[model samples]
Target: METSKETSSNLVKRYQRYLKLEKGHPENTLDAYLRDLDKLLNYFQGEGKSPLEAELEDIEHFAATVRDLGIGARSLARILSGVRQFYRYLVLDGYIKNDPTELLESPKQSQHLPEVLSTAEVDQIQQAIDLSKWEGHRNKAIIEVLFSCGLRVSELTQLKLSHLYIDEQFVRVMGKGSKERLVPISPRALDELGYWFIDRNQMKIKEGEEDYVFLNRRGAHLTRTMILIMLKQYAKEAGIEKTISPHTLRHSFATALLEGGANLRAIQAMLGHESIATTEIYTHIDTTTLRKEILEHHPRNIRYREEHKL
Candidate 1:
């Protein structure tokens, strides 16, 4: 029997397991979601409410209390989402006949555009590399691949030599939830990879790690934190002040292609996005580019120019 005191804790553990094994969420995401759930459960505990005993009014009261406590709209939205997902799991398991969160809604998140580097800025960072170092070529290849392919940091770290199809002009990328897609390789990226491979082939690779694409000086695979630290170092050296990461490169790749008139669906496929909506965010990144094209090519602008004879 599930007691009121233990119900929240027990259900949260079950939800945690479900998120990990069944939903396949990454560790960081799982931890964040679990933390959100804990906050909700603890709030209910103070109100003497069990998971089953809680009503929509009770949840709303908690939301109001958190709002009064000064939780920002975006964070409160995520907390509500966590509660919503937890209740969803309960409904699925027959623990609840109706979800109390069915009528709940997340607050509208502020549209914070992702940071993107221009082609020149990207070149500036690449040129800052110390060519005398053995890792110089390797780091250059990493940057080229990141900006060219729009891969997430985890995908970049997991990249393997076997996944490269350079001769065919494509590289296989395993994205979230192990979903795989073939992203085309740019000529510049391929050239950098070639130069790096020359040094990579000579390294005393670790046993059973021979198939990895980008390894450290010790011939071991690079971690996500290492990639982040490396990007920060290069950004500082290049004299560019914008905070950046592998994801910035990824965003830059998509934004550049969009600015170059690439099809949204084509970008979506290359980025391995399951939803077109997720890929649509790139369209909102730079209205200035779109405005330029409009003024340069719009029929009204062309007619006005011809009429003015200037």
Candidate 2:
């Protein structure tokens, strides 16, 4: 029989290789899994036990301990998922007799809806920007591109001038998995982008930051946190109460496109969603609008009968 330490070392090597080769998990995901497993290993060590020696009861005890530490269900679920994957690899590789976490269950989490802003509210926020200032033009351009593209904050910040195809009216976005997708750019957004680009050239850009589209006063790439701060200030100036974030702009963009009768598949492609099912969440059918549509188009409602002699 393999020693406990030897078995653990082998399991760790196999887990890392599995994540890299078989699973194709991203580096960040691999890091998170390693961290979670480290915590489990540490707990086992403190209790004078080894992961190979751990049974269902030990797993249950670990879950109870984590719950008592006040970790939320969603977080606990993620931790459990990491642990389960590690053990599954161990079992498949014949390092363990049976999967110790075969009965482990993830905690249930509540479904939360994405926040969105109304068109009127979006307009009010845009109107609040003072266009006279140079930064105002830049800010307006930022908002337009954000809503027009449905980009994540990181994507927007990392945007490059070379990605814009103003003549073709489309911009190439680098999304998750390093995948690239083309999103249409509105004429207004293109025009604003033109002005921002002109102003951008006037600044003395740092050596390595030349290609970045959005820049700070120092002419470096913008950060995600800075975008949030900018949006918050704009929201406060607009006096709209609904909480807003850079993501809110993305949500508003999707909502606007759906309301304008854009095709679901086209929207999914534009949003760079890997799965169409993920994109389907954005297709919210308003009951009030559906009722109005029925009233307008229903055959029985449309058929008018003249008063007949009785």
Candidate 3:
């Protein structure tokens, strides 16, 4: 029989290989799963119990402990998923008789809607930029593309100059799961991008970084944190009090497209969302606009009395 320590090490190795080969999980995902397993193992060790010999009660207790430690339901759900995967692998490898987490259920999570900025507010933010400086042009282009394309910060940061088809009025974006999609670029955004590109070419781009569109002072790719900082500064300068981020621009983009009568499927394709339900949140209709339309077109509302008639 394999010792608990040996079994644990072997299980970790197998999990790593499974994540790399079968799941094709990214490095960050793999790291998070590994960390979850590590916490489980440490808990087992503290109780002087072997992981291979742990019962369903031990798993439940560990989950309860995590809850008491202030871990949110979403995080707990992810940890449970990792544990279930691990146990399924163990069972397949003949190390376990049954899955310990078979009866476990994920905790309920609240669904929050995405925040969107109004067109007027968006214009206000754009107008607040100081256009005298070179960075001003670049910032404008960044904000324009963010709203026009509905790009994730990572996708925006990793965008390449080669992916732009300005003449075609479309840009190819690489989204989550490395999925690629073509998004139509508005004329105004295209003009801003063109201006920034001219300025960008004048800068001394570092080696091995020529393909990247957006770059930092060191001519490297922009970090996610920097994008957040830029949005905060822009919002402050614009005197906007509501909380906003690069993601807020994406939400605003989706909202605007839906309000403008864009097709749901077309919006989904542009957003690169695999699930239609994920794209449905952008379909918020304006009740006030609907009421005005009804009042204007209704036959009863159109009836008029003769002038000066009582």
* Regions more than 4 Å wrong, model 3: 1-111, 276-310
**lDDT per residue (tens digit) for residues 79-102 in model 2:** 888989888877777668888787
lDDT per residue as tens, model 3, 267-288: 5556666445664653453433
Model 2 alpha-carbon miss at residue 20, Å: 33
TM-score of 1: 0.59
RMSD of each: 14.6, 16.1, 15.5
Clashing pairs in 3: none
lDDT of 3 at 137: 80
Measured against the true structure, the TM-scores of the candidates, in listed sequence, are 0.59, 0.56, 0.57
Candidate 1 has its poorest 10 consecutive residues by lDDT at: 291-300
Q: What is the lDDT of residue 89 in candidate 2?
A: 77
lDDT per residue for candidate 1 within 1-310, as digits (tens), equals: 4444455667878889999999999999999998888788788778767867766656766786787678988889889988898889888877777888875545546644557898889889999999679999999999988987778777888999999987776788887647787666655677899999999999999998899999999999987668878988999999989868777898887787778666565666667664446656654534334334433432323444677674
lDDT score of residue 279 within candidate 2: 48
The model with the greatest TM-score is 1
Point to the candidate with the largest lDDT. Answer: 1
What TM-score does candidate 3 reach? 0.57
Which of the two candidates, 1 or 2, achieves a greater TM-score against the reference?
1
